[model samples]
Target: MGFPKHLTSAIIRLELPKNDGGLILTKNLYLSCDPYMRSRMSRSTEGSYVDSFTPGSPISGNGVSRVLDSSLPGFKKGDLIWGVINWEEYSLIKDTSSLIKIQHIDVPLSYYTGILGMPGVTAYVGFYEICSPKKGDTVFVSAASGAVGQLVGQFAKLYGCYVVGSAGSKEKVDLLKNKFGFDEAFNYKEEQDLNAALKRYFPNGIDIYFENVGGKMLDEVLRNMRHHGRIAACGMITQYNLDQPEGIQNLFLIVAKRIRMEGFLVFDYCHLYPKFLEMILPLIHEGKITYVEDIVEGLENAPAALIGLYSGKNVGKQVVAIAHE
Candidate 1:
């Protein structure tokens, strides 16, 4: 694939392979623009779990694709799929395991880039395994309007927990409350005192904290946690872009409050994907769950879509639709 010289433009030229392994995917759906990718674009001595994208190479991400050709077994032409792929018109996936066959087509294909994919799994595993929520528990989600946070709030509500979320904008705050059915939502940008804000919403204190944005937010939430509270440490979007990440001041509260905080990556719980689908798909079909997506049209917009996440420009799950199937 050929990219623009300046590395700032959206236009890309696809170079057809000399030989096909019989596995070719024409980008037919959307790609997720997540906050985590921001770190990957930078060159740092501290290596990331995933390799950074090399300049002039087509950027890759989690996206929904449709098979255009197949030499591999089980994958035939016209199969709708979603997985990691390059930021171009088409991608050749050699390892078919990365590409999961889409079994359910009743819902929109874009959903796989978010609510039904990595973000969904992150929320499920973080909440169920790390948070260990009980019915009637009060849950707080930071960066609540994001891909993972939105699902976390909904999952908590489905579990009979009182859920509150914190976002960066009024629109996102409204989305958390009105669309996602969060018990209450607040715009952290408008709140002068975060710790006080947490106290206001969760007077009894938060039983579970689905931490997505860290830094000051985590510090505040820690002070407001109920005794024996569980904190599911998901992604820390707040600290991702910083040259120097902020340190939490109130960590001592963890010991004082007997809080149980644990961090997890979705890969650790991949085995539970089947179980997650069984639980969430029904809720989706029955209308018990709602998903919100902020789709940027075409692969050209992928850069801005990813940058929008940090600035809170995205209203919900940030996705880049490469092509419509």
Candidate 2:
């Protein structure tokens, strides 16, 4: 209701594990601050994919780490890996199965916490798997300057689609148009009416929507969607903090417009990680795809960095760099 508090920092002593039945001890390098984490700060209902972070507990999220010790098969000391780890300096990862041993270290390791990790997968699956497109499809992305949204727009462009994106500030909108090469970009905050803005951008009606911010944006999008338009509901950042969620009065457009709206979790698409890396790594190196990261230096700034996400304070992917090596 008032100001919210997320875990900041704590001092914890670490010990090398005795046995190695696939248990790995790693030093945390970088951690991710994402919109979904906000939902965990509150009490979630049954069947939620992730559980709420308990108070006084070391909060866990996607991170890139250097293996300090690993008695497990296929893992060894000094191997760089990225996966789920606690928000701490050193972490003892018990289950190494889900961990991704870093293959390409040429790119920034902190990228593993962002563009090369969970957020990247979310954009890939949501756009490619869910929002199947043909050339010249009229695409729109909400929160377009974000980590995932930026990638989505670029992916659509590379696939030969005309893309438009909406952000909250002039700077982000500029990044979308100039840096990301979106056909058009707008600051949603400056718009008096969202539906009018969508219409202004998509005069022919939008064919695909890569949704990041939901609620009113979704409702406005529904009104301007073309027949058989596809909506990839990646996240609802706008509704995450509201005590009462904003109801979409235009949901009936799903039937009227014959629209396909689908929601997906990145975990379900983990099997495609190798495939994703194959596609993104090449593009990243070739300069065909570009990524932006907003990283803070220390764990002490982690809480503010994370909380800043809600207000769109960060320009791109938000990361916390806990250590150098």
lDDT of 1: 0.84
For every candidate in turn, the CA RMSD to the true structure comes to 3.0, 1.9
Error of 2 at 229 (Å): 0.4
Model 1 steric clash total: 1
Instruction: List the lowest-lDDT window of 10 residues for candidate 2.
Output: 1-10
For each candidate, the alpha-carbon lDDT, in order, equals 0.84, 0.89
- Summing lDDT over every window of 10 consecutive residues in candidate 1, give the lowest-scoring window: 1-10
Q: State the lDDT at 33 in candidate 1.
A: 85
lDDT of 2: 0.89
Q: Candidate 1 lDDT, tens digit per residue, 199-302?
A: 99999999999998889999999999999999998888888877789999999999989999988888788889889999989999999989899989977777
Candidate 2 clash pair list? none
lDDT of 2 by residue, 1-325 (tens): 2223554555544656565455777889998999888867766564357888777777778889998887778889999998888888887777876688899999999999877999999999999999999899999999898889999999999999999999999999999999999999999999999999999999999999999988999999999999999999899899888878899999999999999999998999999998999999999999999998999988878889888999999999999999987
Off by over 4 Å in 2: 1-22
